[model samples]
Target chain A: MRNTFRASMALVHTTLGLVTGWVLFAIALSGSLSVFRQEISLWARPELSVTPSDPLLVDLHALNWLSQHAGHAGAWYLTAANERSPAATALWPDAKGHYVQRMLDPSTGSPDGIRDTLGGEFFYRFHFELQLPYPWGRLLAGVAALALLVGLISGIIIHRRILADFFTFRLSRGQRSWLDLHNLLGVAALPFHLIISFTGAITLGTMLLPWTTLVLYPHDITASYADLNPALYSRPASGHPGHLAPLLPMLKEAELHFRGTGLEQIYVFNPSDRSSIVTVVAGNAHTVSTTSDVITFDGPSGKILKEHIERRPVIRAYIFLYGLHVARFAPAMTRWLYFLSGLALATVIGSGMHLWCLKRLRRPGHRGHRIVFRLNVGILAGTPLAFSAFFIGNRIFPATMPDRAFYEVACVFATWGITLLYALLRRSNHAWPELLGADAVACLSVALMGPLWHGGYITAVSMTALALSVSFTLGTLHTTRKVHT
Target chain B: MTWISLLFAQVAIGFLLFGSERGKRIFFEGQLTRERQNFLKFCGTTSLCFSLLLQLFAVREPVLDIIQWIMGIAIEIIVAALLCALWEKEHNRFFRAASQHLRK
Candidate 1:
């Protein structure tokens, strides 16, 4: 009976892993890159300055820009400049109710020299959205995360020698080597893997498991949001035209009161009205909780009407889990540690996919390895090729080109599609080295182009790109040698 | 201060791995007695606990510190394994795999 149970668990583990393996690998790899999202953004737009400027000046500039352009907008949202992102982000709803996001310079509201591109935001959105339309991508990512959780648990049941595996790794034994690595990387960081996967699922909690919200507020989702976060203050329009108070000083006051560097989010309801309210949310950098302090002001008077710091224990726990997913409050060393852990997770996913192909190819009467092998090369090796192309496009594209952001994303997909086609055409033995060699060259070109700025962020990005090039070169040589043998 | 904790943690893992049978066989000829293994493990355990306490006390944000410690340990283990592989030399699995490939 015990033997049967173990066998069933092994089957479950294998099936789950293979089913979601490719999508999980893409998500994991992109998510790992997303850890340095802000730095990547800085690298993409070389026109921006290195040293961060005053938050008050940026906030005022954003406010001025939005008031002139999107003044009568449904609402204006701004993220004030800070250490991670020097340029403030201004977002507002258009007449069509579609929101537009833009980054602005503090010196002048207009981005005079900076090019329009997704920057690190592309990876950030792709990890969750897969570049697909609406909730479908998020739904897919959520289900894959949940599947990963089950797969990890089932794998633990099958890999019974947990302790020995933690310290065991033998290279160059083909299938056995892959299995040992998969087990070692998985078991070595079991706690981290479990926490990261579980929290990934919970981050999309309302989407995956919405029964509670359904039962609680069956009629109104907006009302449910309100109930969930009473801290998110809002008010209705008075419908009378009124002059508004200056926004920068008001924002500074709120920042002072909140004890934070910059306001994370700003919501201006009923702009240009007498009853307008501007609410600001800033997460506490002092703790590992996503619980933010909110300050709502009377828009016309700029007087603080309401102040809310989350005190509810239940909300605190949920936000804590969310906090771990973002890792926004981490200091420099801890942030790098987060980056390394993310890479480790991505490796586990990639290696698992490769191991499945290896085991299948070795076994007699198994035919699926042929297609899986091609895909492993295409996505597993090809995605990095696509990333390199994106960086190259950012460097080469015209600065003032219209609809530049659209083309930047298109360049990525086109490069990725070409690699996929190449992988399908060639035999696996040749495809691996060829594509990895291409990836190496692409990375080298981006690095050799020179640092976008002399600032720490851009320099770090250049160094990282150079390191990736070296790693890819080594990979290409290794694959070539294996093929020759 | 954080580096101090990291140093201790690395030393702890280094001691623990040095005491293991595989580590000894790859570097030395035979395993030590059970008593010696226990002593090495005890020292490792003590060092690891001390590192954890030091990290907890040093950082302003204890949560971040604790996470860094856990993540640091994971990376160190992988590095240690790779170092062991490199030290395996020609008479071990590296050459064995090579010979097998040649025969095939």
Candidate 2:
């Protein structure tokens, strides 16, 4: 019975590793790239930087323009520019249900004419959400994270020499090199792997906590969220005729009153109504909560209405966990380290799957492992190739296309789906070289055309992209040659 | 579950180290003779020291801290035993004794 249980657990571990392996690889790879998200953003739009003045100065002017344009409207929102971004953004509801977003010059408050670029934000979004509908993608990532935690635990169990094995990489032996690489990467960054997986699970605890909530609170999720963070609340405006005080004066007043870090964002509620309240969120740059005391002002009078900050330990702990995951307040160097570590993690997972295939192929009568082998090839090689195709499409697709981001995403999945199909139809051994080669070509194409297409060329970022693409392409080709010989 | 997983992983690490050292002498000279205990002592002592540092980190989380500390100590004890066995030049005999004990 114990033997049976052990086998069952092993089966679970292997199955989970294979099933989520590709998604985890994509998550890790993109997460690594996202570490340099801000730098990537600057590279994406260089024209925005030609201005000499601080973005904050322009933000105040833009606020004045917006306020004048708003006329009798209750409130206006201004998202100030910082180092990662050169342009300020303003958002307000304009009779339509959707928020209107416009880039403003920090020096002039006029339109910056800089095109919309998601920059590293794409990887950040893709990591947890995969551009799928919010709840579903986040939930799936959470499940994968749990599986990763299990895989890491089981992987150690199956390996006999975790440390002496560290210095033991026999590259001449076929699958041995891959296995050694996988184990070395895993053991070397063991702390990060464990912490990231655990914290990832915690960040999506909302999906997991429903069972607890159902058992204890009769399935009241809203009440649970409220209980967890009570300072957050929403109220519709009471129907009445009134006016809002000038936002510029209020902004100046708040800076003096708060005497804290720079402001994060100004959230305006019910901007058209008399009861509209403008909440100025001050930045807590040193800490992770992204929380500032909400200094609410009556829209009409610009009078200070309410000020509150979430200071409790439990809530603070939750924010810290999330902040680490998001790198919301992290310095640029930390983000880069996070990115490199994430990339290495993806390499670990990818090489691990490769090791499995190489091992099973060596055994006699390998029919049982064939299906797993084919699936691993399809997912591991196919996902990155598909992701590169997405970026390539982003540059090549006509700008006039409606829902460009949607189309961009569709291209990615379609490419991936086709790669899987190809893997199934052709010799499985061809999967790695072909898909990797294709991805390399596609990424190279993006790197070449990025300056032409985006009109912003920073030598460092472009060179990095080109180097990574070439390295991936060349590495796969080397493996293919090695396998053949 | 987190603590359990961590402990399980660390145990695997210990067994893995023990298994890899099989059929290999501790020193490069390749005889089974157990002279030069300095390297062996350093290995055990350094491992225990790092394990203690890891324990200090583990203690921040109350429920997991004790479990982590136990696992760390257990792994250290295993390492010490393996080192002593190597020093005593009786690891094979120790393995033989264990297998016989299991058979009974």
Candidate 3:
């Protein structure tokens, strides 16, 4: 092995990418879809017709429903209707104290009777959570993000001629073309790649690095959370039952206080107590920082008790980092950039994985390479296939099926598992085009089905899927004809 | 729309630079005049700053707009690279017309 600094970095570039490529690929692709999470949610549940409704009225109805059904819940949450998502949502503690969330039809102010599915939230959650239980998924995602950071830095070191190579792309040369593409994409979105990764790792920092919190609060981990993300105002519930003042007026008051960005989320704490608090958080339509300007009102009097706009540099820094990752404040144009760049990142990971396989294929004893090649094919091609299958499952499953949300998730994993099994079982050369061909079909199906069942900007998702189908078709054809170096 | 304008402006800078003798080593190669090299660098830098200002004035979210500007610059490099790589003389229809009109 060469002992130069660049060579060592090249080793790191290859190793880190190989180690984290599949997980990063999954995260990146899901993240690209997650960029349009709300739009996809609308497309998934076509039963909810888009109707212009007053936020105040919709929220009032949600409060009415909550007070009737879950009035005694320790707390209640309601999200106001927005342009992208017409239906509001209500979340409250169930009989078991665990949270239950349901969509509220703006027309009725009651729990929506629409088809049950996680919708776009499946991808948004899967982007970070990977459908695994709680902290494990977050931890894995955080680690993969960190690995991506190292890989990027190493790639920069190895790519000494970054400026020189910026305009050079020799197409149709198999391994060389992939190398150029990987470098091209990496360089093209370097700033985005750096920021997204740094912010992503920081977004899950508490979970990934528990020791940081432990250092500050040796005993009370909860205290650390309180300091990190403090409520606008909080208090213990009084034993004596007290009124939660009419919510619509308070919401209107908050709207005036927020000065027209609109109310995002409402929290009614200790709903039945004299010490009750209603915390209204501002929407992120106006600011880059994710920290909401909050106004906590006296539940009995419907007057503001405390208000907060985050100004602390330390906390604002943290909020800025988190907001950069979530991008709740981004407009449509910025969101598209996030989506397109995320796809480029995924391409980089896929090409890197393929590069690893391609290099080893030249060796005489290529048995180990075969396993990697199979894994690579299964993951790189299988993921988008499974993502499309999730949408397909949404439409194909009977609307009234119990636990339909779980079935949608299962469809994704099952498709992924079967593809993996097929890849491993079949010859690599045959597996490549076949899996990609299936992906193309699934994408095409997702694209064509959207107009039939849904309308509005949800066509954006369909159009994207249509584009993916075309790209996959081209890739499939190319794979069938090309011989790897 | 603002994003597109910023991107296209950056690509114009790309075109200007790639229009040179393999812009990468122009300074090193000494084939181009020193004044011309400096002039090219000035145009590219000025275009980038102009795009940054456009980004700033277009949106309320300054922080996100700045981040967007950086990413836009990064992406434009690729777009410019692709055009340079794949497209030949036929692609410079506007540029050819401008030159012909100037000669006339």
lDDT of each residue in B23-71, candidate 1, tens digit only = 6666665657778877877888899999999999984777787788888
Kindly report which residue pairs in candidate 1 clash with one another. Answer: none
Best by TM-score: 1
Candidates' C-alpha lDDT: 0.81, 0.64, 0.82
Query: Candidate 3's residue-wise lDDT over A1-485, tens digit each?
Result: 57899999999888888888999999999998888888888788877767877777878877888888887899998877776677777789998998887777777777657788888889999999998999899999999999999899999999978865766665656788789889989987988999999999998988877887788899898787566546567788888999888888899888887877777888999888888899998886677767667889999989888887667798889888888888877888788889889999999999999998888898776777889899999999999999999999999999889888889999999999999999999888888989989999999999988783445566787888889899999988977775352
What is every candidate's C-alpha DockQ against the true complex, given to 2 decimals? 0.51, 0.05, 0.36
Query: Candidate 1: global Cα-lDDT?
Result: 0.81
Q: Pick the candidate with the highest DockQ.
A: 1
Q: Give the poorly placed runs of model 3, Cα more than 4 Å off.
A: A96-98, A229-242, A270-275, A452-455, A483-485, B1-11, B14-42, B88-104
Chain B TM-score for the candidates in order: 0.79, 0.34, 0.60
Candidate 3 on B5-75: residue-level lDDT in tens?
A: 57656655664554454464432343776677667667777777777788788746677778777766666
Which candidate number maximizes lDDT?
3
> Taking the tens digit of each residue's C-alpha lDDT, what string does model 1 give over A1-485?
23688899988888888889878888887887888887888788878765667866877877787777777887888876777787877778888888877788867765557788888999989998999987889999999989989999999998877755556677677777778778877876777889888989998877798899889888887998776666677777777787579887788888888775357777788777888888888845666777567888899999988888777887788889988877777777777777777777777888888887887787775546788789888998888888788889888889789878888889889999999999888999999999999989998888876654654876677777889899999999999999999
Comparing 1 and 2 on DockQ, the stronger one: 1
Q: List where candidate 2 sits over 4 angstroms from the true fold.
A: A1-9, A50-55, A58-80, A89-95, A99-105, A108-112, A212-233, A238-243, A252-260, A288-292, A363-371, A398-402, A449-457, B1-104
**How many pairs collide in each candidate, listed in order?**
0, 8, 0
